[model samples]
Target: MSEPKSLEGVFHLVHMIKRHMHEQIEQLDLNISPMHMRVLKIINKQQTCTAVDIAQLLNRDKAQVTRLLNELIKQTLIEKVPNPEDKRSQRLLVTSEGMEVLAHLTTIDGNMNNKMMKGISREELKEFERITGLMTENLARAD
Candidate 1:
C-alpha cells in the first residue's frame, strides 16, 4: 500500500501559523506574544468583562487568563475597574493604547491572510472556515 495521508498536516499548519504570526509581531518590536494579543482582542470585544468571563469565552483556564491579564495590565494595555455589582471581581477595561495596538494588529492580520491565501477565492475561504469550525467541534467532542 502507498503511504497513508493523515490530518497531521492540519496540526502542523496550525502550529506554523501561530509561529509565523509571533515572528511577525516580534518584527514589529511590540514585545507582545500572540496569546497576549488574543487576550486583548477578547477584552476589546467584551468591553467590560472579568477574567473569569474571558477564560470562559476563550475556553482557557482561569489561572492562565489571570496571568495574561496581569501582563496586559503591566503593559498598560488593559485596566481593571471596580465591578459595581461585584466588588470581588474587577471588570477589564481596554486602554486607548490597547485599542490602537489592536487596530495595528488587525491590519497585520489582514495582510497576513491576504499574503498566505493570495489565490484562494471567496468560496474557498468560506468552505475552509466551515470545515475548520467542524474540525474544532469534532476536537471538542473528542475531549
Candidate 2:
C-alpha cells in the first residue's frame, strides 16, 4: 500500500476501535459519547477539573468542552460548582449517577479486554501496549 493509504488504515483502525468502545459503553445506558466519557474519566480522576482542564486533557476546544460540560450537568451525570480560586470558572465532578455509569462501563471494559485477549499471551499484550504507546508518542510529536 502507499504511505498515505497506510496512514489512512491506521486512522480508520483508531476510528473503528473508538466506535466499538462507545457502542459497548452505551449498552450500560450512560447516554454519553466517547468524548463525554473521556471528559468524565479525567474529571473523576482529578476530583475537580475545569472545562479548560478537560479540553487540554482531551485535546479539544475550550468552547466545545464547555458545551459538553453543560450537557453533562443537564443530564445530572456531573455537577458544576464555582472554582474557589476563579469565580468566573466552574469546577466539574462526576455525580453519584456518573459513578454508577462508570462502574458499569468498567465492567464492560474488563469483559471486552478478556474477549480481545482470548488467545494472546500476557507478554504479547504488553508488547502491543508498549508499541501502541510509542506510536502514539511519535505521532503526537509530529504534530
Candidate 3:
C-alpha cells in the first residue's frame, strides 16, 4: 500500500475497533461510555487517583474529567474518599462494583484481542506492536 493508503487503513482500523467496543459495552447495559470505562480502568490502576490525575493522564480538560468522575460516582462504580496526606483533595477509588465491571471489560478485551490476532503469528504481532509504538512516538514528537 502507498503511504497515504496505509495511514487511511490505520485510521479505519482504529474506528472499527472503537465502534466494536462501543457495541459490546452497550450490550452490557451499564450505561457507561467508553471514556467512562477508561476512567474506571485508570482509577483502578492508579494508587491515588483524582480528577486532576485523570485529566492529565487522559490529556482531556478538567471539566470533561469532572463530568466523567461525577457519572462514575453516580453509578456507584467509584467513590471519593478523603486524602490522608492532603486535606484539600480527595482520592478516587474503584468500588467493588467497578471491579466487577472491570473484570467483564477485561474479558471483552481478551476476546477482541484473540479475534484480531486470529490469523497473525506471534512474530508478526510483535512487529506490529513495535511499528505502532514507533508511530505513536512519531505523533508525540509532532506536538
Candidate 4:
C-alpha cells in the first residue's frame, strides 16, 4: 500500500494527539473541557489578555470565547481585572488554582510529547521542527 500524503499524516497525528489528550483530561474529572483548558492556558501565558484577544487567537467567535471565559471564571480558574488602557475591556488572569491546573496540563503535554518522540533523535526532532516552521510560514503567506 502507498504511504499517506504529508498533510494526511499530519492531520491524523493531530487527531490522535487531541484524542489522547482528551482522554487524559477526562481521567482528571476536573469538569473542564479541552477548550476551557486552552483558554486558561492562553490567559496564563498572556500578560494582558482580553476575551477578544482569545477569540482572535483561537479563531473562534467572541461569544464562544466569552462562554469559555465565563466557565473558567465559574470554576475559579481565572479572574478578570480592569484593563488599565481600556476601561471598557478587562484583562484575563489565571488564578493560583488555575496555575496548578495549568501545570498539570503541561505535564500531560510533556508526557505525551516524550512518548511521541521516544525513538526520534534530537537532530531529527530539530529538523522536524524546522520543516514544520517552514510549512507554517508557507501557510501564513497564503493568508
By TM-score, who's the top model here? 3
Clash counts for the predictions, in order: 0, 0, 0, 0
Give the per-residue lDDT digits (tens) of candidate 3, residues 11-117: 99999888888988888877888898899999999999888899999999999888899999999999999999789989999999999999989987888898889
User: lDDT tens digits, residues 33-140, model 4?
Assistant: 778888888888888899999999998998888889998999999999999989999999999989889988998889899989999999999999998899888987
What lDDT is obtained when candidate 1 is compared to the true structure?
Answer: 0.86
lDDT of 4 at 70: 90
Give one digit per residue, the lDDT tens place, for model 1 in 110-130: 978888798999999899889
Model 3: residues with Cα > 4 Å off, grouped in runs: none
> CA lDDT of each candidate?
0.86, 0.83, 0.91, 0.89
Which is the leading candidate under lDDT?
Answer: 3
Candidate 2 residue 83 C-alpha distance from true site, Å: 2.0
Q: Evaluate model 4: give its lDDT.
A: 0.89
TM-score per candidate, in order?
Answer: 0.89, 0.83, 0.93, 0.88
Query: Which of candidates 2 and 3 reaches a greater lDDT?
Result: 3
Arrange candidates, best lDDT first.
3, 4, 1, 2
Clashing pairs in model 4?
A: none
User: In model 1, what is the error at residue 102, expressed in angstroms?
Assistant: 0.9
Residue pairs in collision within model 2: none
